[model samples]
Target: MIGSLLYLTASRPNIMFSVFLCARFQADPKESHLTAVKRIFRYLLGTQGLGIWYPRHSTSFKIVGFSDSDFAGCKVDRKSTSGTCQFIG
Candidate 1:
């Protein structure tokens, strides 16, 4: 379930934080974590039309990228978690 949600995050950036929060418990999830996951699914159902959309244009395009990372951000494994976003114009 978590894996599926994570994959969906590529097109649905709004759920990224919530999905990652639930992902932290993949190895030893509890009832509370399950509830949180259910909430995310409910949210998705409520906002079925939400997602990234690009506008149509003609001659030229510009691509921009932004990224950030934190060292040892993970509590369980002390691994870095990084994120990036790209924009086209």
Candidate 2:
């Protein structure tokens, strides 16, 4: 199920973080992890019409990117998860 959600992240960036959190527990997921995954699915169902939009014929053609991550954000392991998004015109 996590695999399917990861594939959906390509079009649904909003669920990326939740999916990543659930993915980290794939090796030995507990009941709480299952609940979280189900919640994500519910969210997807409610927001099926949402998606990215790009404007055409922009006078300024440029590309921008941003990324940030917290240090030791994970409680189980002192690991950080970083995310980035890019916009091009």
Colliding residue pairs in candidate 1: none
Residue by residue across 1-89, what tens digits does model 1's lDDT show?
A: 99999999998888999999999999999999999999999999999986556656856767799999999988999999899998888
Model 2 regions more than 4 Å off: 52-89
TM-score of candidate 2 versus the correct structure, residues matched by position:
0.59
After superposition, the stretches of candidate 1 with alpha carbons farther than 4 Å from their true spots are: 51-89
Q: After best superposition, candidate 1 residue 71: deviation in angstroms?
A: 14
User: Taking the candidates one at a time, how many backbone clashes does each contain?
Assistant: 0, 0
lDDT of each: 0.91, 0.91
RMSD of each: 5.6, 6.1
